[model samples]
Target: MRPAHLALAVLVAAVWGVNFTVIEIGLDRFPPLLFSALRFLAAAVPAVFLVGRPKVAWRWILAVGLVLGVAKFGLLFVGMDAGMPAGLSSLVLQIQAVFTALFAAAALGERPSRLGVTGMAVALAGIAVAAVDEGTTGPLTAFALVVAAAACWGASNVLTRRAAPPDALNFMVWVSTVPVLPLLLLSLWTEGPARDLEALRALDRQGAGTILYVAWITTVFGFGAWGLLLRRHPASTVAPFSLLVPVFGMTSAALFLGEPVTPLRWCAAVLLVGGVAVTSLAPRRGAPARRVDPDPAAADRAEVTPSR
Candidate 1:
């Protein structure tokens, strides 16, 4: 990869990492579900018109959208609002890789390599350490909610593999439209129509800015750049850059949110990030070694949601 492209990769990771704080900031103004609804609304609208529909059936798009957009993001924002620290939430959410591996084993009969299983075990143990630390550092409910989001993300990854849409960016943009109505309905139901109205009326510049950052910068630009980089280079070359996200997430959260990083928390971060790196970046044994272009859709689904 060129130095310029590498910088672009780092920039996208920074945007994604900082997004945890952005979501936290946005939630201060809009209720979680409503904020999420508006976020996707911003993501889908004009982009959908420009991108056109993906080649896959509408049902698949709807399926991926509901699971990825609504279920995963809804839980994520709600978790953050419930007191998941921005940096910690970013760290915890990477568990989706572990869950994805497990789900793929069961649902798709794609067996995990020994390295993958070991990496997941280390990652889970790290989560246990982080959870124990979080009991004092943050809300357990928040942690649990983020974990649930990771699970939903894992499920979405499986569904996406099953669907196997061509053109990931287009699929992502179009599927984004699927969640707008449902999330709005949910916002009205849980947040109450009156409160929802109040929240929208109360939206200040910060709230609006945060939503645009999430919608266009993180959701659109982050995924779009990643897909383009993958197209230009080998997955091995481009994919490893994702390891920088948690590093950026933690550092940015400390700077912006003043979230403390305890000694145990640092240890846990190392374990979790290292484990995920091993799980995602390691080569599998007994597999044919061939150079194939990474599937843009799979890459989109894998790194894309957590990048949210």
Candidate 2:
């Protein structure tokens, strides 16, 4: 990558990192499901007109939308609202790499390298350590919810790899269109109309700002930029930067949210990020040397590494 591209990559990673803190703030004003619904709605509207026709079939779009947008994000927001700290939630979600690897093996018959297996072990160890810390400092159920969200993310990663959309931005914007009604309905059914109405009545500039930030900035800008980087560079070269997310997430949380980075938390961050780095970069044994763009669907899902 050129120096400018490197800088751009770092910027995107930072945007995604800070996104956790933004979500935490958004949760203060909106119920998780409602917040998530509005985010997709805002992201899809004007951008959909701009991004062009969807490149993949509607089945792929709908599947990814349901799993990634609805299941992964829904659980994530609810987990955070339920008391999973933003920084730690960011870190733990890295476990999706392990889940992704395992899912690929089962669903796609892609065997992982020995190094990949080792990396998964290391990542799982990190999850265990983080579990210990969260169990001590926070609600275990919240932590579990985030882990479940990560599993959904992993499943979605595999689904995306299968979809292999050529244009990440277009694929993602179309995917965005699929989730709004389902999430809104889920919010109404579960979060309650009165609570949703109360949140809307209380909405202020900050509340609307939160929606725009997550929608336009994080989803639209962030995904487009990351996809551009992948198009310009090798996936291996670009993938490691994702490891930076938890770094920025924790630091930003400490600075902005006053969330403490406890000793155990620090240890978990190191182990999880390191493990994901290795899992992502390690080549799979018996994986065919296909022409690249083999899995920009993974790219479309907001991660550079198709392996995850």
Candidate 3:
């Protein structure tokens, strides 16, 4: 990677990492589901028109939007609001790499290598440790919700890989549009019309600013830059930068939100991130040793790391 591209990769990781805190900030003003709806709404509009047509089938786009946007993000924000700390939420979500491997095996008939299996075990063990740590200090239900969000992320990764759209950025923009209505309907139904209305009535500059940050900074620029990096370089070179997310997440949380990173949490971070590294990097034994497809969408099948 060129020095500039390396910096850009780090910048994207930082944006994604610190985004947890941004999400935490957003939740203070809007109900979780409603905030999520607006986040996607801001992300999709106008930009959707700019991204050109969706390169993949609508079904794939719809599947990803529902799973990644609705289920994953909806659960993540609600989990944070329910008491999952931003840093730990960031850490736990890394489990998506493990879940993606498992889902690929089941759905796409792609098997993990022996080392990949080992990495999955190590990563799950790390989650167990993190669970034990969170149980001592936070709501177990909240942690579970984030884990479930990771599963949704994994499911969506498989869909994205299968979609193999030539233009990753366009696919994501269209996917962003799919979640808006479902999330708003869900918010109205579950969060209650009164609560949603109250939140809208209460919106201020800080609230709106946070929404734009998550929507444009993290969702639009973050994913767009990431897709560009993937197009410019191999997935192996780019994927490793994602390990920095939790590091930034935990540090930023401590500095900004005053969330303490316990020693146990540190241990969990090491295990989780390290396991993810191994899982993500190890090549399957039977697959031919070859270059990743030059197309960004196809390259992402092996490794696609998106923002929080």
Candidate 4:
């Protein structure tokens, strides 16, 4: 990667890593689904005007949107609202990588390499350890909800690969539009009309400002910059940088939310980070030496799509 691109990658990671804090702040003001709806609405409007529609089948587009946007964020918001800590949520969500690998093998006929399998095992064990830790156990159901969100993220990964939109930016823009309606409906049903209206009406300047930051900086700028990077680099080169998100998330949570981090959580973090590195960096047993092929078609179509 060029120095400039590398810097951009790091910037994206920092932005995303701190997003957990943003989400927590937003939730303090707006209900989860409503906050999500507003975020996507912000992303969709400008992107639609600037980038236009991507050349993708509608079904695939909607599917991607529902899985990535609605399922992933909705469940995450609910999980967090239900008492799951932001730092741990950040760590557990990395399970999507393992889910992506498994789904890719099942759906795309891609075989998992020995390193990939071993890394997944180590990561899962780490997750199990984390799951058993007191921090995670406090709100077991919420933690379970977050796990489900990770699974939704994994499903979204497969759909993204299957869709294979022509332009990554346009694809992101169009698919981003899909979540608005579903999230609105979810907000209505889950949060109730009265509470939703009340939340909206009662929003102070600070709360509204938080929403704007999440919508513009976190959702729009973050996704747009990430989409650009993915187009320029291989997924392997770009994706592993996401492991840093949890690191930043934990740090930010500690600093801002005053969330406690225990030794067991640290051990789990080591396993999770190590597993992600092994999964990302280790070569496949029978795979070709070249990581990035000139022909995009020859590149390994693993299930784990970039999460820009």
Instruction: Encode model 1's per-residue lDDT on 13-70: one tens digit a residue.
Output: 8898998888888888999999998988999888988886577888888898999989
Q: Rate the local accuracy (lDDT) of all candidates.
A: 0.82, 0.87, 0.89, 0.79
RMSD of 3: 2.0
Q: Write the per-residue lDDT of candidate 4 for residues 79-147, one digit (tens) a residue.
A: 888888888888888888788777767876666789888998999988888888845458788888988
Which tens-of-lDDT digit does each residue in 17-126 have in candidate 2?
Answer: 89999999999999999999999999999999998898998999999999998999999999999999999998998899899988888987779899988899889999
Error of 3 at 53 (Å): 1.0
Give candidate 3's error at residue 132 in angstroms: 0.7
Highest-TM-score candidate = 3
- Regions of model 3 farther than 4 Å from truth: 285-297, 300-302
Ranking by TM-score: 3, 2, 1, 4
Cα displacement (Å) at residue 187, model 4 = 1.8
Question: Best-fitting candidate, measured by lDDT?
Answer: 3
Q: What is the lDDT of residue 187 in candidate 2?
A: 100
Off by over 4 Å in 4: 134-137, 281-308
Worst 10 residues of 2 by lDDT: 299-308
Evaluate model 3: give its lDDT. 0.89
Clashes in predicted model 1: 0
Encode model 3's per-residue lDDT on 1-308: one tens digit a residue. 99999999999999999999999998999999999999999999889989888888899999999999999999999999999999999999999999988887887777899999999989998999999999999999999999999999999998887777666678878999999999999999999999999999999999999999999999899888988888788888899999999999888899999999999999999899999989988875543343666654465533575647
